[model samples]
Target: MCDTTPKTPIWKAIADALRSDLAEGRYTPGDKLPTEAALAERFGVNRHTVRHGISALVEEGLVRTRRGAGAFVAAIPTDYPIGQRVRFHENLIAAGRRPEKQILDVEERAATDGEAKALVINTGDPVCAYHGLSLADGQPIAVFESVFPLSRLAGMASALQDTSSVTEALRALGVNDYTRATTRLTAVRARATHALHLQVSEGDPLLRTSSVNIGEDGQAVEYGRTWFAGDRITLTLES
Candidate 1:
């Protein structure tokens, strides 16, 4: 008797081949893939089959399709650790990627109820707010808003204006060190502001982190919220 096992579909085979190529670094992140017609000609298949293969890659988060720009390799998510001492630049550097921070806005605002609770301050107390973008290898990874008690860190705004690093800014204001005291994470849909900042469409997935940092004296020094692009970062809990 002859074996009668079914064979894999050509489109699935194509997708497998592309996935292998990606794993082998045949195409780097952000590289545009061949056009559908070109792939079809190369694989001896129809355009519809090529489209199906591309769709599979999209579902697997290995490729992204633009309306007129064809498919492009998706960026591999960076592993970002959440720990007592979390430094964005140090983390990216350890991952062999360049890190950058862009300070978007800075202002002094009255603390909201949540902010006051996180920072252990009065609800109407003034706080210095810093809004910024964090990037790895030129791609936006997260948008962050950090609030500090103005009475404690009066020069935080000026320090932030001079440098993009929040740690450095705090250090400049005589805070030698701070550690993460608490963190809460949730999955959320990107809003208009977040989408614009992260270069993603509205309703795209985002990882939201709300955290509090404390000084050696065990007093809350900062309250921060960060919205990470879902496809660009993998959050890790560190011991």
Candidate 2:
């Protein structure tokens, strides 16, 4: 007697099937998936098997589990460009998302060693620092701290108070335009404060960007550090 049968785990098979459905647009981004009971009945499997399948999807970032609400398809990441003319509002608008910013703190601060080097000012020089949270479609996406040399942009703090945009504030201060001079990126785990602002669990992934902006005359105008939710935004580098 010759007997040959294919051996594959049922859970993996279910996962594959669900992945296919996702690829075929059966479940679009942000769509709620069927309940475990429904999937178990449909697949003629136990709830545990269905749960295992969903767990695979979650690991793949194709689905997100909500407490007491089952699972839902994850949102497509917004394409954010890091370019010479990086504008947060413009970037989110181009990605078809509504952009919003909340200014958390604005005050005069003495420049630290790093800020002094970036801003071409002496250590302890007066600098205007702006701290804010950026959101896309009402979901917090990043937190930013931007420092400006107050000697050059003396009214920057007042300008920022009237607007939620750094670009606008700089423009109000007579800096018609600025270009990204340098950017250094690093991957880090979200700390407690970062997690609270981004609405993610502690130790979740985050992208930290440290950058400097230069004005038309090639003077460093702004030094900024931003922490972005790794799952929400996809950083794209431009030439």
Candidate 3:
């Protein structure tokens, strides 16, 4: 029998008790949790304490509550990192899931001002734009739109359908020599496409990364923007 004793802050103790119960399969994912009043009675705490415990779980992304209904377990989040140059397939494999891609748009067009600056190419330079969603275990996790200099990477658009990996595609194009090169990150709300792909509420927290891959000669080869669901990914950077 598990101890029901409370030894720490009342809220944490309550939260831990609930966490343990959920982990023990007393309640499964998507199971509607007991009401705050009922939980307070079970834990011998006040209603406010039960609310705090549930709030903790919500913050941890363990459970979600629907107004006018009740709280329920949230599906486990998949861990992904942002501060690296690893291919999407590699990252998901490391995290124990099969990776997949849904190509959205793959075509060549003249670079826009932003793409031109990011890739360090002259405005109107031909660029191959590839837009897709990166998925793991069939769940969409990221939306990517990357542009590569068509002048530099001839036939890249054709190459990428077979290999969406920026690194691998670059290698096949004789531009194998590239570096993490440059990266800028910001917290954003999941915009139109990302919101749809990630299935999160519009404006949910997101990790937005803009990166440019450059060759050894200081030439930018690719510029990409990626949005990762905050709940599904963790970004780690080490020196």
Candidate 4:
């Protein structure tokens, strides 16, 4: 006897095949997918169906599209721990990925009211602001801005100029260690500036973390904000 059943939709089937290939690591992170026309030929479907299939991957965070370029595999979300000791270099090394920071700018300016409050400094007091992009395996993952009370860490800007590692910079200033004092997490849409720096589309998902780091003296040392590419990094909390 012969059995008959409804066939799976072509677009769904296409997405399934692509998903399987990804699972098998046929395409690595940042690998561009074949053009819609090429995939259409292989699947015997039109470009629209192929696009529909790719769109599903995009929604799943498995793929991303560029305005002028084609679709590409998205990076696997890196597991990031949020705890007392949050060190970027140590965390990425343990995860078997090379971490690097590209310094965007470093400047000394008057602290804004919010910054002053976070660092326990007077409004309009001098603050050294450091902005940079955090990358894993050379892919942009997060944009971070850290503000330090210039009066306390007078050499922060110069130290940052010598090294991209924040931990090292603070160490040069005789800060042996610091720990997270408080953290607030929220979800936000990417702005154009962030999109330009992070290589994500404007309005893409982002995870924002605002936190204060304290020195051994129990004084606020830094007020930092990190905006993570929602699809590229997973923030984990320790119980």
> Which predicted model would earn the best TM-score?
4
Which stretches in model 1 have alpha-carbon errors above 4 Å? 1-26, 32-50, 65-71
Roughly what TM-score does model 2 have, to 2 decimal places? 0.77
Considering only N, C-alpha and C atoms within 3 Å, which residue pairs clash in candidate 4? none
User: Order of all candidates by lDDT, from best down to worst?
Assistant: 4, 1, 2, 3
State in Å the error of residue 98, model 1. 1.3
Q: Against the hidden reference, what TM-scores do the models get?
A: 0.82, 0.77, 0.71, 0.88
lDDT of 4 by residue, 177-238 (tens): 99999999999999999999888888989999999999999999999999999988989986
Better of 1 and 3 by lDDT: 1
| Least accurate 10 contiguous residues by lDDT in model 1 | 64-73
**Candidate 4 Cα lDDT to native:** 0.94
Better of 1 and 4 by lDDT: 4
lDDT of 4 at 190: 95
Tens digit of per-residue lDDT, candidate 2, span 108-184 = 98999999998899999999999999998877889999999999999899999999888899999889999999999
Q: Stretches of candidate 3 above 4 Å error? A: 1-60, 64-84
Clashing pairs in 1: none
Q: Write the per-residue lDDT of candidate 1 for residues 1-239, one digit (tens) a residue.
A: 98899999999999999999999999987678999999999899999999999999999889977555678888889999999989999999998899999989999989999999899899989999999999999888899999999989888889999998888898998899999999999999999899888777788899999999998789888999999999889999999
